[model samples]
Each structure stands twice: as structure tokens, then as C-alpha cells.
Target: MNQAVQYKLKMALTINWFCYIGLLVLFAVWNLFLEGGSIPLWCIQTLPLLLVLPGLMQQRYRSYLWLCFILLLYITTGIVDVMMPTRGWQDGAMLVLSLILFFSAMMSSRWHRLQ
Candidate 1:
């Protein structure tokens, strides 16, 4: 990959990592406190993010590649949540963030492969 593309990929990956984590934290907080969601259920819901977090922090290309596939669950959740009347905005945010994360991971993986 070109140096410029590599740099952009790095930035995108970083942003995706942060955004993904942030979205999870935000969701947890919103559900736990605001919506009175169950604690155990919340943990279960966030488990996928936790599972992939180490790889994300390590900046592994293979991890990013896999994460692209794993993130589909989140995308589907976002789509379902977006259909609700009350939390549509938050879900829309998740949908957008998931898309960003997906695109960034895809590009990052491709760029790393090129390297």
C-alpha cells in the first residue's frame, strides 16, 4: 500500500477502535442506568467487543479482518434498534459507527495485506 493509504488506514483503525469501544460503553451506561436493563444481559451483549478488544489494541491485520465479519452482529442490532421509536437516534448512531468501523477494518486489513 502507498504510504498515504497506510497512514489513513492507521488513523481509520484507531478511530474505529475508539468509536467501537465508546459506543459499547455508551450503550452499557444507557441501558444500565437509564433504561434499567439487566446487568447480566448487558455483559453478554458487550462480550463480543471485549473478546476482540485485545486484537484491536494490538493492531493485528488478521484481527481487523476477522472483526469485519464479527461486527455484522452489531450492525444487525443497530438496524433493529433504529426501527424503534424511542431510541432510534442512539441506534442510528450505532449503525453509523458500526459502518465506520466495518469500513475502517476492511481498509486496514487490505492495506496490511498489501504491506
Candidate 2:
């Protein structure tokens, strides 16, 4: 790839990794610590994200593609939560993070293909 393409790919990958890990940490803090959810519930919530970790660590384009799909579920959940009467900042934060994660992951995969 040319320098410009490499730079774009690097930036996308950086944003993708940041948002991906941020979402996971957000879920853990939201469900486990703040919400005081059960261990099983927390595990269930994070399992999908966790499943893609190895591939992500390996910087596999497929993982970034799959992550975009998985993020849709979280995005849906975030939307529902934010619409609720008792919604809090965390709900909005989750929605924003998931959206960012989705786009960044998609871009990352596309840029990866260019490499």
C-alpha cells in the first residue's frame, strides 16, 4: 500500500481498537459494578465481544467484519435503553460508543482489504 493508504489504515485500526475495547469495558462496568448484575448475566452480555478477541488481537480483517455485525446488537440495546423513561448517562454513552465502534470496525476491515 502507498503511504496515504497506510496512514488511513493505521488511523482506522487505532480508532477501531479504541472503540472496541471501550465498549467491552463499558459493558463490564455498567453491568457488573454499577448495575450489580449477576456474574452469569455479565458474562452473557460480554461473551459475544469476548469471542472475537483472539482474531482482533491477530488483526484479522474477518474479526473486524464480524465485530461490526455484533455491534449492531449492542447498538439496538443502547437505543432501547436510551428511550426508556429512567435512562441514564450510561445508556447514551453506550449508544455513542457502539455506533463509533461499528463504523470504525467497518472502516478498519475495508482498509485492511486495501492492504
Candidate 3:
């Protein structure tokens, strides 16, 4: 790709990550101080996952790898809850979202292919 195109994509990706983070913060405020819905909590809790896009943008393999480990634990806990049905069906939803977040992050990163 040409430098100009690469620069534009990078900018767009950066803006996207910022939007994700900003949304997460908004969700956090909402969940903690306002609505407190399951979806809001989901967004707040998973907000940290937004870091992966920027990490990918910078080609920070170590950060990406770290988030993968974190994602593993998150997914595992969600799966356990799903199997046991501790917090109702939301557990399964959490698990599914975790998987989606991990998948999304990896895919958004292009699995190191973007660089």
C-alpha cells in the first residue's frame, strides 16, 4: 500500500480505537452511576479490551499477546459460569462476548498481517 493510504488507514483505526475507549468510559459512567443495565456493565467491563486495536496499530506484539492471555482468563471464567449458571443466562452472554471481543481484536489486528 502507498504511504498515503497506509497513513489514512492508520488514522481511521486510531480514531476507531478512541471511539471504542470513549464508549467504554461512557458505559462505565452509565453502569456505575446511572442505568446499570447488563449491556452497560458489559461495555464497561470489557472496555479495557479496546486497547488491543491501538496495540495492533503500533505492532506491539507483546501487548497483543498480553491481552490474549487476559482474554483467555475472561473467557474461561465466563465459560465456567455458563456451565454452572451462577448469574443467570448472562454468564453465557459474557462468554460469547468475550469470545467475540477476542476474535474481534485479533481480526482487527489482522493477526499481525496488517503490518
User: Which numbered prediction scores highest in lDDT against the true structure?
Assistant: 2
Error of 2 at 31 (Å): 2.1
- Over 1-115, each residue of candidate 2 has an lDDT whose tens digit, in order, gives 8899789888888887788778778778878788555778778878999899999999899999999899899899999999999999888988998998899889888888887
> In candidate 3, which residue ranges exceed 4 Å CA deviation?
2-61
Q: Provide C-alpha RMSD values for all models, in order.
A: 1.8, 1.3, 6.5
Q: What is the Å distance of residue 2 in model 3 from its true position?
A: 10
Candidate 1's residue-wise lDDT over 1-110, tens digit each? 58898788779868887778877876787579766577887787778777777887887888887888878988998888888776745678778888888988888887
TM-score of each: 0.84, 0.92, 0.48
Off by over 4 Å in 2: none
Residue 58 CA displacement from its true place in model 1, Å: 1.8
lDDT of 3 by residue, 7-110 (tens): 65465445445544554554455456654357655664666566565675676646555665667876887778778834655556556656655655454445
Q: Return the candidate ranking by TM-score, descending.
A: 2, 1, 3
* C-alpha lDDT values of all predictions: 0.79, 0.87, 0.58
Worst 10 residues of 2 by lDDT: 34-43
The better-scoring model by lDDT among 2 and 3 is 2
